[model samples]
Target: MPGATSPLPDLSRPDVGAALFSTWSVGTPERQRATVDALAASWNGRSWPTPELLSQNVYVGTDGDTLMHHSQWTSEEAYLTFVRAHRQARVDEIDAAVPGIERNGIANYRRYRGFDTRTEGDPRVPGCIVAIKADFDDPDPDLRRKWIDLVIEALETDPAPSPGLISADFHLIVSGARHLANNRVEVLNYAQWTSEEAYDAAIAADDPTPEWERVRHFPGFKGTTAKRYRFERSFVRP
Candidate 1:
């Protein structure tokens, strides 16, 4: 993993209670990553809450407008504290450094399962990731758990039956959005594949059991959306 980012926080720690995912944007991938790199360096260990776990400065691809910053914190309060401080001042520095870049979205999620804290290097997905965020009414706890399991199976097995997957992470919303706000995605599913082309081919394969059919029309299924992210900068705790 040459050019790999370093000093990433470990996600496996029990103390790492929450994750903050913020998406920002710049006109080009080069500027998007460069600006965020500068912003991250500016706050490098200088802010509150400290983001003690890992942070992904993911902006390596040249297609999309949104670049994501992923960080893990010791607790929800610590996350909020960092958010407060970031909103108060650090954003100005970002704006000054990258005049056109803007924050596209922000989410604070309770890490539910499969964050893969065991690994000691940058995340190994060679191509890109498919991130799904969804909202649903909790009608049955048992059934919900079952659905989660089944979906995880899809991600792990990759309904496409390919070995291109590096990893997958799933989570449920703690309190990120509201139903009325129209952005209330309560559950999340993430999958990594060799390339965007591979993902597209898999989705088009007409296979129903592993990924699409098992979850999309699930018993308690409600609504969801997807975003694509290129493998960017990732870190591991020393």
Candidate 2:
């Protein structure tokens, strides 16, 4: 990672070949904090044993009931190996501190495209992360690519810069049994913003924008959901 001082993960880091995204529902703001605290303690207590585990960045949803974990790995095989050998113990440790946490299944993805809109001389840091998930009716990779291209075109043709938008990195789900079972392809847009207020302002101003209309009406788009989060902490392997 070029900017070591920043806690935000470098979404386009070349060495990271795979990423795992998971979430936990803790039921309250207090539980959310406890979950993050327990996770940091658990990660720091041990000498990280898996060298392929590049980084684990934790985020707390602004909604007050969720925690998102974004982890980077050298390869999918390395992640599977770790899950088989050490995942249970780590899960148990966190569960001990925050019982009854609802664990959501993990999704695997690879970064496909990214856009950086930060101003050259600006020193502002991203204070909010907006994760937008889009699902399609089919599992065709070409369909996914086409939709992403439409998004890029929309952004590029916009007459003015989107206020508060820092960057957006899109990830396509890795095809596997889980995806086949669901019969849908998923895309995640990991976006960063200068602050929640700026994001809210953009949303308030977003109806009937000509550039976004095409994407909003694009065919084969099943549905989409978005959430805002605050970066809590990140642990990088030594």
Candidate 3:
């Protein structure tokens, strides 16, 4: 795991056209560390032949039983090509190192919008990352777009949003192929905060925010789930 402490991905990077998000249930804190170590070893031990694989980041969940892998790619086509050629062998290598990882299915997405709240003079590094999942009852991509618009409008118009929110990047799950279709659509919010306490304070004060209330009750909005994590390690293409 040497040289594994790299910087997080630039969510607003124009060259990054697609992303893949997946999680694994490792069952214990010890296993969580072991899993991340195994992944870093696998990624850094050899030369990555696929130029399209821009970066891969690993996060250890605060709850002690989960690990999230967020990988950036040049395009979905490149990802598919990599999957066809290299995915399984890599999976086998990792499995041999750390067995019984209950992998959640990977979700594909494209960054649709992003907002950065930090000013020019700010020098704080984000200590917490929040992954928020907004689910809709309908599969229509238009509904997903409308809901995100509402969220952006609410945040933009709010007069006194909680401080310490570094940035929020919204992603829309890609849809089209039969294998990717579902009855529900999901929008993911990848948010960075100065600290876990800052995020907790915002959640405690959520009830009085009129802007948030409007977005919460928007039509077709089903429900949301969120989890917090600290960046564990990352690997970028050499």
Candidate 4:
């Protein structure tokens, strides 16, 4: 087990039941890039699974020129350190890097726990969603406002028929990071689904509507893509 490492720090097995799904808006391309680099560098110092299997992607929404920068981390402690270490000062720095960018939208954050299966027992796959991060972008502030309103409508009005999604949380990358780097990264959305199937199906719905495309795939966003793999969780951590 030369390169082998636990998905969860200090935990014997993967905690399949829990996970983290988060979305963020990092202002602009330059700001988002800075945030991404800062995050990678920060996580490099933390102990966790190999980075090779990790996934990251960026998407741009047409609704208001919003961009979503997404990443799936492999460690909970690494994620925690990321949050606690980077706050308001980080926020200020991202703003300083971009200059005069004001967003009226609030970011979301969540930590999902309790699984139907145990990651410790399963050899196929281990651990829950270590972390999910996304960022939004818009060319016009007014459009951003309108887009937010539309997003709220979709989240509430057009709820999924059989949503596998569970609890969701919210947060904004504030400022003044003594532990982590200085960069503003907002936590826009987070949720826990019952299973990977439910998660995939929830997102798999194909709607011809333009709005639907905006949610699934936006144009302004940019980043490395994701290559999926299938796994089953048989282990549990107590």
- For residues 40-81, what per-residue lDDT tens digits would candidate 3 score against the true structure? 777877778487888888999999999998989998888888
Write down the TM-score for model 3.
0.93
Ranking by TM-score: 3, 2, 1, 4
Model 1: weakest 10-residue lDDT segment is 176-185
**What tens digits encode model 2's per-residue C-alpha lDDT throughout 83-199?**
889888889999999999998778788899988887689887899999999988877888888888888778777776676889889999887754312334789999999999999
N/CA/C clash count, model 1: 3
Worst 10 residues of 3 by lDDT: 175-184
Angstrom error of the Cα, residue 182, model 2: value is 7.0
Global Cα RMSD, each model: 5.1, 2.7, 2.0, 13.7
The full ranking of all candidates by lDDT, starting with the best, is 2, 3, 1, 4
State the C-alpha lDDT per candidate: 0.59, 0.84, 0.84, 0.37
Q: Which pairs of residues have clashing backbones in candidate 1?
A: 8-236, 9-53, 12-117
Question: Which 10-residue span in candidate 2 carries the lowest summed lDDT?
Answer: 176-185
User: Which residue segments of model 2 deviate by more than 4 Å?
Assistant: 1-6, 178-184, 207-209
Q: For residue 17, give model 2's deviation from the true position in Å.
A: 1.5
In candidate 4, which residue ranges exceed 4 Å CA deviation?
Answer: 1-131, 137-150, 176-179, 182-184, 208-238
